[model samples]
Target chain A: MATATGTARTPAPAAPERPDRPGPRAWLSAVWPSALVLLAVLVLWELAAVAFGVSQFVLATPSAIAAETWASRELLLAAAWVTTQEIVYGFAISIAVGVLLAVLIARFHWLDRALYPLVVLFQVVPKVALAPIFILWFGYGLTPKLLLVVVIAFFPITLNMLVGLKSIDSDLLLLMRSVGATRNQILLRVQVPTSLPYLFAGLRIAITLAVIGAVVAEFAGASDGLGYLIQFASTQLDTPLMFSALILVSLLGLALYYGMSLVEIALARRFPHIRADVR
Target chain B: MQSRQISAEGVRMRFGSGSAAQTVLDDLDLTIRPGGFVTLLGPSGCGKSTLLKILGGILEPTSGRVLIGGRPVRDAVGDRQIGLVPQRPALLPWKTALENAGLLRQIATGARGRTETAQAAERALALVGLADARGKLPHQLSGGMAQRVSIARALAMDPAILLMDEPFGALDAITRDEMNEKLAEIWAATGKTIVFVTHSISEAIFLSDTVHVMGADPGRVVETLDIELARPRTREVFADPLFASYSGRLRSLLEPKAAV
Candidate 1:
């Protein structure tokens, strides 16, 4: 047991060395193909709109949309900021509530049985249907929009958290228990750390859905936001402006989604065992 | 740490309820002296692992009881007198080798500080010849390396008794041999009572001072043989004439039970 060869034994195949992180060249190589595809699609759209003599009101060319976006830069930027704020606030609240409820439900069987069905039902019901109700209750302020975002975004987070908490290895649990570890110790030291990957998975899904929720709530009724701006542009028969607003909404969603990814990456680095896989 | 005596008094374990219930371990009785190395050798479904669990106080017997250090097994467990190594290493993947080794310190005292806990773990790792690999994660460890870490984790507690459920059952033949030799050395040095469970006949004969051959289908000990081999029993012992007799007797005892 005290021999040097015993300590010098080779690592098992099951426990392979950690993979190297992708370098700058690898990053550029991955990005450029997708970038070329997007460029090609834009060129095709511009040619199709011009060749077919499509009216700008019916289908604006990519160039027309870009020009309109540049002309209304201040208005678009301000609206994007409002929608971005709603997305961030609503997303943060959703995460907090979702994790809390998940813990409560997962920790107690009776609570889970009582609330799980109702949660599933709520998740199934089109959250857009609740947008008008939120508007009725909270009026045209940010509260209604934020509530709508929470309702839509909270389910995935809750379900994923439950999955994560419950998915611990039975053997690991037994190992901890054999050492006389208390219930709380087992939970905090074992279960919570094990569930981090699943939690991140849910966060990615919830974040993207939050952007959609904010847009739907704005469509129902809002004084300012990309969704409201899109509705206004549509009413004025300004197709290019509507497209620009739609573009801004997507851009906001992309930013928030990648923001979650960045957090996930940093966390995975800190605890490499739960390296959250890219969604 | 000095060794502790362990005994199971007519222990029985049953699964299910009423008439539909099946007995896994029935009227099983065992006793081990302090500083003894004993192996419960049996085939699969023999409930050897279940018996080990009962002795460790992780599972209560359906009837009867286990006693360690002249106290109820449950009490002994409460005092953290036993260290158990299951079939798998079961190390927390998020923790490094040293951290995994020191896990018992946290459980033993609820001590959240890392400094003292780390020193204890480091010492245990060195005993298991894994001091150099302390910083590696479980994923970076080989099967034998991971098992060594698990053993170190148990040793860090300096428990009175070590209960292993086929700790090397997953390793290749060569690694298993190496582990057996290392375990023998640890046993000689520490003199801790060890109750190991394994199905391999040669394994039982090689390391154990006494082998309790257990029969399956409601597991119970069928025979016990005192290994009269000389001290520092090495690989060359396999060539000894007495070793063949012990192996033959153990095999004969197992075959008749297996046929039933």
Candidate 2:
């Protein structure tokens, strides 16, 4: 969209004088707003906790949560490792199965006709509610948590990828036909490459869902995990540890999100011309 | 495929079945000779683009035939004899300008060696004054530059005929004029048969050797005017008295008249 206006707006001669790459300070500039907001929120919470004389069990202060996280960092880290495994393994399975299902659904009209409504029904079945049943059937091992993760995370991938495959400009299709391109050529050249952005979009949503699913499964029935830690700490009236576990869970999700982004960026750079935004 | 004479003989195109059917094109008959530059000029709903599509073998006519070089449209298309540029550039964002330009030669048939095909695409880019911008991506170039790449993509195939559907319609007026000048130059340089579709009278007059004015409401050709303009038409031709006369005649043919 900026193509027409870009050349007209900026004179070409000035490009040589401009910096080719962004400065190191650019990263700091980008993150400062969010960091400032987070700092302000933490300070406000600590002040309110002290001024109101709230019980530690009710609401742990920011300092207490931080200190507790550092003090028992080993145990918390171990539990975080288990939950991280569940989330990562579950997400990988979701990507494989979801992308396959989407391709199948998009390729065959009869398959789409038969499976779309069923897929929608599965998505709306409330995946978290099924955790107890899965745990009951599969035992309190990693199987139930992984199953829960797949159940919750797979839907968005299939939905976004299928839309991407099906969504092509009609004019582009005509252009392909005019050139007498084969079906295989159109799929490989146009559909699949164009679908990268949508696929990445689905992955972004699915990764978060995978985390939630694993934690919720641990909540329903689990011998280990960050969710189990949270339950144990709450019962022991140790809110600081509960808050620490929660922080770890959030950090795990953040790490997965940025990790996927990095992978996408690397892939985009290696390809014919896929952009870093995955478009 | 090499003869380059494309003709639509008694072609009829209908959109739907039974009473709900709409005839988008009806018994349309026209021929474009080898190395001729023709424009299908009309307002919206005149089925100019549809005719171009039928000629390109992208859409099959409901009743009647479109022949290229005295053979079926399909045969010509299979031989890679038809090159089309749509209204939108439709350049894949993932590819560089050069890659996008050479896409058809790479995909339509692998008969040509990679080196030869790449050189052909590069030559077409040079014809369109885009040799320097070949490394740029679609988003890096201006709208006119992107459309020029599309033209290069079409020309890369060494097709006998070129079909363009308002290739410059999306561009700004200044860019469009620049493109027209470049296109006139390309036509003169290549001497490939071109069937252009557009609603702009000035464009039809400036670039076309023959303008086929079309009428809507059961779309059909109404008038065919031969342009007497010389080769390599420059911007100064816009000031010529003959140019104004041609535009005046085309405008009268195009605009709907109100009943007294």
Candidate 3:
């Protein structure tokens, strides 16, 4: 806050008084209770498998799953790499294409009317249903898998970017016009920067979708990858291996999601307004 | 002293068409002299903003013409001897205070060097008493600070004519008075012709060399009153007899014609 006076201006005091005093360490400490609960649940899961004498074919013990994961570490690591490559490439393509489409749609009302429904239609239809069609068209190769990833990831990016681009405060636009700013200047300086946070939000959602799309495409038809490993384990009745593969898939998704969140945080540091409503 | 004269003749503005057509201003005429601080005082829908837009050459009148320095305003482009401060602060949230102020130079001169632009921006911010806040983003600023940054941006453009549309209307009473004094000082120093639009009678008396009272329902200028107050007017002037007289006259003009 700034206080204005007749002769001078004084900067407002920095300290803000509040009743609830949650320090930085206190905030981090709050997460410990949730972690403890998750640990307890995992313990119960392992105990339950042992107490019921559940067959290894149906329910794998945590130790058994860990052992299997360690045994086939190389294969699992290779598949993880392949899936990461596909996700990275597909996610990059999706962001580029989504932003381009959003800019076009936002710039031209007629284009929006023509293409917006198609985008919604594509998004609503299950990507799993399209995986088979993608395989049929492109065959069992990286192309089909990458295409599936792009398809699944593009919608949220497009919708978020479109909404962000169109969500400009009209008064700001008028101000720019009054300043005699060119169209290009307004777009680059105001519109694009304003939409960045929304774009990053879309990126975070799209990253998880990227992993799912890759796995689904592999499930539909693929010779290698985590999806193939899961399928191989299911056929052999190696439930521990199947559980290990599932865990690897979840970890990969978490990594990518957190990676995007880190980028968003970095950008927000540069542009503080990027912080959402909570701030 | 740099000054620019503005003339708007037989101006008419209409929105939409046919049954949906709404006429905002009809056959309006006004002239602002060089080196003058003129305030447009009106009720809510008096087309003061529309007239400002027309004067700035952002919008052409549906009919008639606007002239800046005896020349048709349509020929003007880019900076065009005009600077505008909208009712809202309208600062770029992504840019810091310094960067936002420097944007005027960037837009006008196509200067890309950061150091030079930063220097100029710092000077403008210092003028507005925001030098310490140069690194702060718009969200980090209070409403008054954001508004001050907006003014600094316009001032940095150094246009011969300044057009402000109720720029301080959003501030609190104390902040508004403070801003008025700062604006008066700046105007005194720069001697740039200013046309300000406001709904407040006291604000008009406090800041303007002359006040133009306008009426709504096909917005038109109803009267103009001259304020012969001395230079470097302080906040105390708000309680002066001349200020009261000018405000009382404006109140009378606005009251009887008031709708409902």
For this target, which candidate reaches the highest lDDT against the unseen true structure? 2
Order of quality (DockQ): 2, 1, 3
Off by over 4 Å in 2: A1-24, A270-279
lDDT of 2 by residue, B34-115 (tens): 8999999999999998899899888899999998889999998888888889999989876777788888888776765688
Better of 2 and 3 by lDDT: 2
List model 3 lDDT by residue over B188-232, tens digit each. Answer: 887889999999988898888999998888889999899888877
Q: Sorted on lDDT, highest at the top, how do the candidates line up?
A: 2, 1, 3
Kindly report which residue stretches of model 3 are placed more than 4 angstroms away from their true locations once superposed. Answer: A1-28, A108-110, A277-279, B1-3, B77-79, B112-120, B256-260
Candidate 1: lDDT of B195?
A: 91
Candidate 1 stretches with Cα past 4 Å from truth are A1-20, A276-279, B1-3, B112-116, B256-260
lDDT of 2 by residue, A94-141 (tens): 999999898888777898999999999898799999999999999999
Query: For residues A169-278, could you state the per-residue lDDT of candidate 1 as single tens digits?
Result: 78778878887777778778887778788888899899999999999999999999999999999999999999999999998888888888777666665465555331
Model 1 clashing residue pairs (backbone) = A11-B142, A12-B142
- The TM-score of candidate 2 is 0.92
Candidate 3 residues A1-279, lDDT tens each?
111211112323452322223568887799789999988988998999999999989999888898999999999999888878878888989999989999888877899899999999887888878999999999988999999999999999999988888777786787677656787787777787788878887888888889999999999998889988899889999899899899999998998887887677566655655667313
